[model samples]
Target: MPPRPRARTYDPAKTRAAVTAQLEHVRDAVRGLGEEQLAAPTRLGDWTVRELVAHLSMAVGAVGRHLERPAPPAPEVTATGWVAATAALGGDIDDDTRSLAASAAPAELLDRAAARFAELLPQAPGDRLLAARVGAMRLDDFLVTRCVELVVHTDDLAAALGTTLPYDRQALATATRLLADALAAKAPGGSVEVRVPPYAVVQCVEGPRHTRGTPPNVVETAPLTWIRLATGRLDWSEAVEEADVTASGERADLAPHLPLLA
Candidate 1:
């Protein structure tokens, strides 16, 4: 596997709006859920709906706080690398999320956090590089990560309530591209082409070179399914059984390199 690549170019204006729009989508869905629904269990291990909401709020809040400090002299990690490296901070993150969840009602907590985030957003410049503990990353890059957080957690919320929520296209696109890029970084090779149609397609894994038309090895899935696979929400065999994923060619089986984050 090769090191993660620098972030793909993002339109700061579009990305900012994408983050807010995606959050509003989640918030709207969250508001319609009853109290009992909020107490249900999410697919994230033992995390309940309430804890998931609190964590989403934390993802948005981190940006505001990082913008409060000075940018680092240089980034320690690339944008795609951030996804895989997140588990490194898992312990403290879980503790903080649980603490936040315990301190207040989910609705009220997310409301206040959203309000705080909105107030600080306009004051932040797109070029500003936030001094995040994971690494120093641009404000726009941070917003892209928020899209992943919003999309993934929203899925958790829906799974908990036995319902499905509509995903904002731009949010889904951003999340798909980021994760796709991460996979290419983790398993660097051009022998296989992994496609998430209409969103992203990345070549990865080491094997025979295919420089011409019709690559020999390929894996394909929709954006949501790809996200679930990357995050460990769904297993390789389960996806195959459900027909959510389609793999072909000898090098296409990726079960050996999965659940990038524990």
Candidate 2:
């Protein structure tokens, strides 16, 4: 069968603004966390709050570095492929992030990183193509990945701190749509409708397609819950038992296709 269609086209201007706004929000939250809090353990296995913060900066600042280089001939991958690309550089990225966090004060590093992103981001053109290590992808398409990092890590920070940080609407929406599309791409099914309330809804899993009325299979959760599930931060069974996710229908179970980033 052909690949399931990707949902939710993002406007470059809106996406850029969202990334900027969300990064600022995360930086502001980071600034408030004391050194002790910054050193706290995160769900991301060996990564403390410090490493996570550094990773966020790496994600945002990468666009600047790519933009500084000449544009690539073409995008070797789609935004859909980016979700898979993340794992390839995991080791090196984590190493650099750990070194950066160790050498600088978390607060100061966040400040400098935010400033650098602010300065370099504006220089990138909307249509500029980036030669990402995983594959060539448009600068705008790459920004969508940034939104995922910013949103997901922001949630991680909040979870570790036992507090909630305000999420930028656009950032949350873009992150939701991207992950949802990634799930559809990975599963490539028309059986179940996965609904992330107030942000996105996608049909995935293999079965008979529902053309009208209620689908035979349905799964539902809020955006953050879905993000956590998709990224392995939350377990499917736990979510299902805690009422964080609602699932139904014979084909509704998505356990096999989950934790897409791992």
Candidate 3:
């Protein structure tokens, strides 16, 4: 078997700042919601806007909760691995988000979550291990995953409300890079060049390797479009039909390897 591709690295401080900025963006948008808007449905199964908003708090604030617990011994997941590990967790996540949505108003839930996150962030180091829901991971790695949760769900929240929320530059870039790397890990090779400009580029899918110049297979798209595709928010054929993604070469059809996370 071919060796596993090395996961890309992320800076913990930038990740932390991105998470904070994005959460504030979510909080700001949610604060203006009326009951009617909150009841609107999102593309994420049965979750309505309210449930989706509540889930952001649960997702980002998990850091503080983990820090309060006993440290786990060793790392078991990386930012890329977390993407592969999350598909099996849908049911549990749904239950938890529903419970959270029912417990408090979106504004209240997010405010408290944000306050706690800010209070706890400075107390620990990046290498501090936390037993994340997927597996034990360094605080730094886990923070990187928060980029995915915030950026993707923020997109969900916007789609549900028909509004655009601010995308923190670092948060969007980190999530884009993490998911891009996840794609490489999912289908390791060197035949295709997948690029999300101003953020990441990775080669994957086994074939004749491209040592230089134009690769035989190439796929390129905007970062948000790439994130939506990687998370199954956008369909492969549909993206191609609409010209949201450009593909070249037979090996470049990525429909068979997508939505690395549910």
Question: What does candidate 2's lDDT look like per residue over 1-262, in tens digits?
Answer: 8455745678998998998899889878887778789889988888999888887877777787777788889778777788977777878887888888788877677677677777877777766799876888888889888899899999988888888899999999999999999999888879899999898889888779878998989999999999999998889999999999999999989899888775
Q: What lDDT tens digits, residue by residue, belong to model 3 across residues 167-201? A: 99999999999999988988888988998998999
| After superposition, candidate 1 runs with Cα above 4 Å error | 1-7
Off by over 4 Å in 3: 1-3
Error of 1 at 123 (Å): 2.7
For model 1 the local lDDT of residue 138 reads 73
Ten-residue region with minimum lDDT total, candidate 1:
1-10
- State TM-scores per candidate: 0.94, 0.95, 0.98
State the lDDT at 38 in candidate 3.
Answer: 96
Candidate 3 clash pair list: none
Each prediction's Cα lDDT score? 0.83, 0.85, 0.92
What is the model-wide C-alpha lDDT for candidate 2?
A: 0.85
lDDT of candidate 1 over 8-86, digit per residue (tens): 7767777778888888877787776677887788877788898888898888878777876778887666567788889
Clashing pairs in 1: none
Clash count for each candidate, listed in order shown: 0, 0, 0
TM-score top scorer: 3
